[model samples]
Target: MNSMKALSVIFIFFLSLVTFSSGDLIEDVCGTSSDFKVCIDALRADPKRCSTDKKGLVRILLQQCSTKANSIYNEVASLLEQAKEHVLIQCLQICKENYDNAIDDATSAIKYFDANDFLAARTSTVAIASAPDTCEETFNEPPVRISPIKSKDDDFMNFIGLTMRDLIEDVCRTSSDFKVCIDALRADPKSSSADKKGLVHILLQQCLAKAKSIYNEIVSLLEQAKEHVLIQCLQVCKENYDSSIDDAETAIKDFDANDFPGAMSAVSDVVSAPDTCEETFNESVKISPIKSKDDDFMNFINLTASLINQFGN
Candidate 1:
């Protein structure tokens, strides 16, 4: 009986030693991060996450990022209600969107990490790291400065970003596609790091580029159909293209000047111009004795309209 009791005490002591060693390992790992104190505290706060491995440490960091991002998102949303100044309200709105994206990316990182897709996990982590900068960039324009809320939120997000970045660096040290994935994401115009206004600008630019392409296509089609009975229909479509191009250009200018409402109105005009052109073509065909259809031009107009509508939304 005494032997059995002594053996049990020895086993317990061994277990205690293992636990302590695990904790020390976690601290040592976290110490390499930018914010070691915060990292250590977060790891210690969740003892269950101390798996004494790099992957486990990354998971813990991602989980903390998700929690912190969600909290910041909620706080920014709540602040929107009390915002009275137009500039401040706009900044908050942008911040809210950025935090929303950060939360989503963090959640995605956790999912990817669970699946052992370290490349995707690191990509998401990099996006989350940029969210705070994207949010803060809105107030960098002249005559509008960062507010107290912005300062606090920036600090909070920086802390989370630094923590996640350290984990991402660890993952990238072994990930073959880490650099490629990161470069692709950064080059993408729809990067999560882009501010709302920047995204809108990109959308507008796309609209303009598409509109110009369609305009050239319409001109070519009109010339080809000049001797055909569909000449009238082509002419009407050409006129619509002219108007659409003009409206899109105006919208781009308005957007550049920060006149959001005006830009939206111009985009609406661009969207409707194509519809009216298509309608006129259909009506002309219906009245004409020649039962002919140009599916190609119709499809082109339809696609352009669809793209414009999507960007407007």
Candidate 2:
């Protein structure tokens, strides 16, 4: 019985040593971050998942970012609904959009991380780091200054930025794709934009380019389709794409002029074009003989529609 008790004590001692060693390693890894305290606190809050490696640290940070983004999105959405001042409403709308984009970007970062594409993950993470700043910048203009909102967002963004900078520095020091990853993140339009309006401009430009590409592809596909029903469906799809392009162009004009609501409304129209095209095919009395091709085209159209919808809300 004494020998067994001795063995149990030894086991407990070794287990404590292992736990202390893990905590020390976590501290060392977090010590390299810009906000070591924040990093340590965050990681310690979920010690089971926070391993001692750099990748583990990044994963935790990304998870935190995703959670914060979702919370901010909900808060901003609620605030927007309650807002009455025209300028405040516009600012809140922009904030809501930024938070939504941040959530999407963080989700993409997680996906890239899961795939071991650190460069892509870094780019998405960096974009998310800029979201709070982009939202706060909307109130920097004349007669719309909201000090409390700006202050809160600024502090939150600083925390996010510090952690991100630490992650980027670690990646540059350790990853073989250091230069490529850093360069890609630095050039990301979402991360580099100076303000909400600038970000909107970039989004609109990308949307317009994508819309044009989809339009061209559909037209080219329509020319090759030999079946009458397939041709008719493709033609309808082409017409929808054409309308989407026009609406996208109008959205760009609205965005450039800082007419955000107008831009959003126009982009919403662009989102609906694909659905209208698909509905046309669905309403046809005769079932499409080229059912497979019809489904393929419709799927493609839906994807394009979904992409455009992101730009608006």
Candidate 3:
């Protein structure tokens, strides 16, 4: 028994050493200069400040910057937001340069996160990896006209189809505010007309199918959240009204001008819808008075989502 206890003690010591070492690695690589040193040092100075485990590194990094982290995180976020791998890689490199020792880890993360390829896959099956060096491939630039919309590429159509599936699954089935998510897609004026219309038609059909799930929770349990969903939908509708109307108008113009393909593409934009439900569902949780922060927010969301599925039907 004594030998077993001794072995256990040694094992624990080894584990603690590894844990502390990982924390050090995270801290050293996350920041530059003595400023970061101070933040990490605080963990040693006050046991209370440092987490007993190493999962707290991100929290510490955020705490160290406080308000500035928001901007930094935003920059990181925008890379994904606009689906700009080049800019994202630049930002990640900058992050590592600022925190040198973590360069390998950061690089590894960047290498693994093929955001360009991933987002591209979302829209089409041919994983057209974004050539980071291509000067014209920034997020603001139009999506590369890979092929005519009617091209016989099964993968491309599958890509758009899968994305629509996700938008329907993640958003349309969850809340009534799906219109908001669709608005983001519409902002890109260059998307093919058929693709846009097909995407929206899929979502609307899925929502109607899921409407039965939220029948009970629709009227009560989470009215604030319900209203928030409606508000998001209304807001998106308000913003897209002009654009959608314009797309329809443009489609007519293209058709009259005998631009069959262009008219179809234009028509797609006017008809396409994206799911905007998640944002409102999330926001409602933030302002909810009945539930404490620990009150199983995901479960609440699921419940409210069920309600939303039935709301408009």
Candidate 4:
């Protein structure tokens, strides 16, 4: 642990610049990774991300994978010891051997990484990533039985893959549109790299921007709103947007204070602005000039919320 801590500090100094905050560093690193959400989730899940640098991310990921690998190795061993069926025993034998190599490789990989041996670290990590494949295939051979440790294999793979691709594919899968969410995150490099808290920060900024823009537009519309009904509706909308902006600010403060529920409540408040605006127009002319814009902004807010739900996991 002491060695790891020392290595983490060295990683921060050497891999990340002093000018950037942890949030900035996370955005920059995740921005460059093949999987943004995976990287950010992995980093932001650990409170240490706020203090670490790029290589520190690698250290953290490697350590996580290594620990999981050890546990999986033990799990495989336990299964091997308990196997009664000849076929299952054979499969477990193969899995045990695979885990043996995997554990060794993981150990070497961390030592190599901490020592700044990039080539070796890459080699070991690649090995670790592929280590479970043989175990999986062994069970699928001949009569084709399922691997007892299939879930464990997959779990380790996801952790290891966080450095490369997304581990938490389910985050998007459960969403309204997985591809849309993925594209949205990937489209913005900083956003792609953001952890849960960081993502909320970005999403709220968008909400705030949308609110202010819509508010200004509402004010402008008031200038041309000749009909009494239209004028009244516009006034209501302006006030609604004003309330939303305040709530959004409150959400930001609550989020920073570690009050997640409070932040989400504030986020929920943002909905009333758009909903009430649309309803006000519907009650009168049944058509709002700002309906389309409000709808679009609302979609953005929902997407942000969906993403927040995923990252919160």
Best by TM-score: 4
Model 2: per-residue Cα lDDT over 161-278, one tens digit each: 4334434434334423445444433344343322334433544565566667767777787778887876888788788778888988897887677566777678777766566666
Against the true structure, what is each candidate's TM-score?
Answer: 0.43, 0.44, 0.18, 0.46
* Shift in Å, residue 112, candidate 1: 1.0
lDDT of 1 by residue, 105-128 (tens): 888878987786766766676577
Which portions of model 1 show Cα errors greater than 4 Å? 1-23, 31-35, 50-54, 156-313
**C-alpha lDDT of residue 288 in model 4:** 91
Candidate 1 weakest lDDT stretch, 10 residues = 3-12
Positional deviation of residue 140's Cα in model 2 after best superposition, in angstroms: 1.2
What are the root-mean-square deviations of the candidates from the true structure over C-alphas? 17.2, 18.1, 21.7, 17.1
**Candidate 1, residue 197: how far the Cα is off, in Å:** 23
Full-model lDDT for every candidate: 0.57, 0.58, 0.33, 0.68
lDDT tens readout by residue for model 4, 1-313: 2211121122222233334554578767656555566666776777877777677766776676666677778888898788899999888888888888887887887898888886566557556655566788788799788888887665555444433224123344555566655655544434322344554576667778889999999999999889888899999999999999998888778777777777778888898899999999988865798999889877777766665555445
Q: Output the worst ten-in-a-row residue range by lDDT, candidate 4.
A: 1-10
List, residue by residue over 49-158, the lDDT tens digit for candidate 3. 44434424322322322222233334434444554456545544433233232223223322332342233323322111111112123322454322111121222223
Candidate structures ordered by lDDT, highest first:
4, 2, 1, 3
- Candidate 2 stretches with Cα past 4 Å from truth are 1-23, 50-54, 163-313
Number of the predicted model whose lDDT against the real structure is largest: 4
Which is superior by TM-score, 3 or 4?
4
* Least accurate 10 contiguous residues by lDDT in model 2: 3-12
